[model samples]
Target: MSRDIHKKPFDEGTKAKLAIFRDYLREWLPVFIAKREIYWNTINIYDFFSGPGSDGFGNKGTPLIILEELNPHFDNIISKKLNVNLYLNEYDQSKYEALKKNVSPEKGDVRPYSIQIENLDFKISFKSKFPEMGNKGNANLLFLDQTGVKHINEEIFSKIINLKQTDFLFFISSSTIKRFAEHPSISRYIKLNSEDIEKTPYHKIHRLVLEYYKSLIPQNKEYYLASFSLKKNAGLYGLIFGSGHVLGIEKFLTTCWGIDKERGEANFDIDEDKIQKGQFDLFTNEVPKPKKVDLFEKELKEGILNKSLPSDKAIYLFTITNGFLPSHARKIIAQLIKENKIQKSSFNLSTKVCKSGALVTQVKPL
Candidate 1:
């Protein structure tokens, strides 16, 4: 049998990162559901590349992070005998053996979840398990993480993705293929993500891969991409994610987008806005046409001048409520300042970081 090429069990640093994010997700989820009661079997998590429960190599894997995250929520999860249902897929025999030991209780049925594990390689049976993932108003959050992309075909992912309520967070290692892209033969794997096979170039497989993944989802929904690196050669890998609802997007951002204490120096950590469709087109070279943002600011300027807002403080209020970029909003303020529609000596003179978090100074003069 062909062996699955992969990243070995995680180390302590990796585990710690996982724990932080797991906790982050859990924190947002409750805040996400604050308006609604969680019905039975309404939530689920799918750890597709789940390593064994522990690394013994001095790290806890996803299983450990997941269990730890779930443990606190156990009471709410337990409906009669069932805690929450966890589906764990680990291909390695050694890892599975380790997981079996860690996941079981020392005594009775003290565990709060219903779990199913497949000890075979994830590639061998990942597609086959789709139907079993099931669905609800909530969903199965599948973590299709891997050391690199392999054995993934569009058809296979479509099956997993077609689950009405299912969303995916994929670990896509982009570094490996930059060099490999020179050879057309090595590009077939990239084509697996193709949107339209007929239109795709046999050479530009990476484009196809992205298109295919996008094709698998319902459009007009938000998705996200975040990158992490072990070293320079470690390359950029995208953690691409999708969700079907706005509330999920709101929950995801509130937790994952750690507050930028300094602000606007780095791109607003819009990474947390998961349901946000397409990324904020960051300016490179020449500032790419401000598109939607420039226009939005125009409206904001009009609103500010005519006293549509009580104060420039109200402008910040608009930003907080509307989630507009500080840069974009600042453009609106800059225009208002130039037009002389709104003057200095209006609001507090000092705290002039405009409502959008971008710098625009229309401070009232002393």
Candidate 2:
């Protein structure tokens, strides 16, 4: 049996992971709430592995954090008469009872939104709730905080890929996959090469797992996936966020970059960038730079000069897809303009700009 995490006070790593979930929800709720009449009229949120509402020290878990975030939106939800549903499920019987007691409408004051607390296994819960998620008028957010990496197999992920207006956040014990790469049970779920898993650095096992999932995306599809690695003690766990729309990716990336400005991918310095020495340019002195940002900037500059990124819209997509914010891409564009490599153009890289048909000028090379 898997160990229970809520028996103890939530650790820093778990807190960090929950923080991302909370922050993303803060950004996520308003979009659908504001658009209740205009776009999606209903919002569905699922926490598949919700624990008892809090840890031993009473630090709020995902269920409580979610309610706290949604509390502020109750007025808007009430005014618009929007249909918002929250599904919180815990597989463990003990945890489920605790979840019910803690998350009861009377206790949490979550009466404004329709909420359901279940004690089903993830697979069963997902199967039952999936059809509701497929509704065209509903916006869905699914959080799978599984104890291990087995629940989100290819079969499950394939179904998620086909859903229209859904975004998902998945947690996995990536280090477990590395440690048990060759195990028969593990291989059955994720078909990664044992040799390759062994060769990957310990800290990057989570990223490797994410890459495996990325490979599962269909070539013709335009899905976006990003990862945030959490280092807990000696093990590495991570969260993978997925969405079909650029706006969803934009929100997630914003939350991630806010947490880890250096890499926008982890709680710690995953790249050991802080210790690395900056190469001195004989002509000009420069401060040490972050490795990931430097690499992304170099690629962004090359893509523009090569015409691979030919317009603001294309650059905007490139920026988010490469796990960056528009501001980062704009910084590169600013330098390019100063160097006379590209002609001046409207640097408005917002999705609204794309929809408004304003980003028409092709990036002219000088």
Candidate 3:
């Protein structure tokens, strides 16, 4: 990819989201590769709406960022001779050419990476190649980083979710959906019913869409989801992450909360906080207090009232369900133990090495 193409300039919010994407892959790929080492020989990555290598201002786009993120592990991967497949798609001809040039290894670049660039419409291309993309014994990560919600319909989402060992990250413009809620075209894309469109509050549309998407997934298949709303002030977009494992949701939420700890938009009750912390003056001396934690504790108590889970499973449940971190779960459980409200098999279990199933039961108030 020539760095000279006039590319689109990413705003501060877009940059933050891109950084989150990179960080997620950085945390996930290594762990995923290790876990799949026993069963798979290849790791396949797909970016359906990959843009040119750089923006008009010459800033690296998602494709280049993905390449950069993967380059560091070449030495380790090459030693094992593990096949790493990269499939990037760009509908624009100029961007397609640039993406090919950018991902092609330059001189002295010793990375043994298999890269394929497609210049066709992503929806059509993905549909035609869906079966080949999801080969058994190979793990896949699809990045449907489209410009908007035009192509991400139910068909694409269901196919990806149903595919064996495949996970996905995509962007959704909740603000746009809310703004155009009444429009028939927008309602069709978001799958909003007439009743929902008429009766549902605008603020609740995003949550409804999320729940609807989750409901579409088959019940037998387990998926852990995490989402982050970006630039609430600007009302741009939010990211939705769906993974086949609990660890994936944990890592994604960890990154999202780490980035926006003050509000915890991805996992916490940010709407209430935003309403309460509405429009503070810069000159004002008052500082908004942190949001309360009692809600999370209550959630934990209910989930663990009378449960026997591998300690890891308990942590995963609370984390994904209530956006509590493992540390927070441990703290809440410790408090319950202290109050004699709950009983645990042992107190020595740590989050990372908690392999044994821990039996926990709530004590009845006599």
Candidate 4:
């Protein structure tokens, strides 16, 4: 039930990740909250691994970060008289108390948020209460920012993924999984039999685990996955985002590329193009070089050759297949039209244009 019992300072990589997650929520919350106008009446945000409000070294954990990000949105929602719910769950006693204290409004502080702070185990809390949350017609964003993968087993993930319009940001230490890929306690969750674990290359274990878990998700659901890795020396841990909607995936990748300047896309494998020895660039955003741009353009052309894909579906296929952002795909699709390699049957070639039911066809060679 407990993670590494000893406490340590929150590393810089973790802090950068927290900032990226916060920025993503800052952009996504308004759009998500406005869903009340079209689809849902309420938005529920669940921070399942609500850590001790801070690392005790001045660095705030996910719970405090999420609360701060949501405060302004909460006020806006209240002004509009719409409902938004915050569910914060922490199992550890001291951390739970800290989470509750941190989220509680001080004297005369009127923050219009319906906050439910809990001290129960996340699995039990999620399983018992998720039915109500799922049935409420709320767009739920569950943050499973755990210390490890213990609480995010197959059963829990399946339950959450089955809920309607729900998205999750799950944190895991790939180093831990690589070390324990053959361990009986964890092997079953990743669907790795003892034999497969023994035979699989260590470098490939993370992909195997990710793909296995992804396969468990419902096939009929249009799910998109993107992972952002936080590197500490040779070790890497990161957040895996699962969303049933394309917009969710878009925002997640946008955050990933924004935070990690050394890497353009969300690739799980460590890249040879390492960042400066001791530097982390949280501010600089280097545009993809011409080489990478051409690679993506080539993939986009291959995506629709001889196939008449709806503009929206083509973007989805191109993005998923190439690991480029949706915007990247749109840019390449536009370039293709200009070069006479692709034709758009309807609207002008643009990011939002694709989703307008326009038909896109690859201009086959004569």
TM-score of each: 0.59, 0.94, 0.82, 0.82
lDDT by residue (300-358, candidate 2, tens digit) is 89999999988888888888988899889888999999999999987678666556546
> Best by lDDT, which number?
2
Candidate 1 lDDT score at position 313: 57
**Which runs of model 3 end up more than 4 angstroms from their true locations?**
1-8, 34-37, 194-205, 232-234, 266-269, 272-293, 302-315, 344-366
Return the number of clashes found in candidate 4: 0
lDDT of 3 by residue, 228-262 (tens): 76653346467888887666777777787678765
TM-score-based ranking: 2, 4, 3, 1
Question: Per-residue lDDT of 1-366 in model 1, one digit per residue for the tens?
Answer: 112322455533254346435744575445323324444345667777887766565566677777777666655555433335677887778777778887776676576667777787776657566656664444567776576665455565656555665555565554445445544543666654223443543333333345556665556633432222221122333344444543443333343334322121112222222223344545543333333344456667656666675465556546433434344455566666676755644333122433247444333311
What does candidate 4's lDDT look like per residue over 180-281, in tens digits?
767766666555555665665554444555666677877787577777666644555667788777677777777777765444433332444444545555
Question: What C-alpha lDDT do the candidate models reach, one value each?
Answer: 0.51, 0.88, 0.69, 0.67
Model 2: lDDT equals 0.88
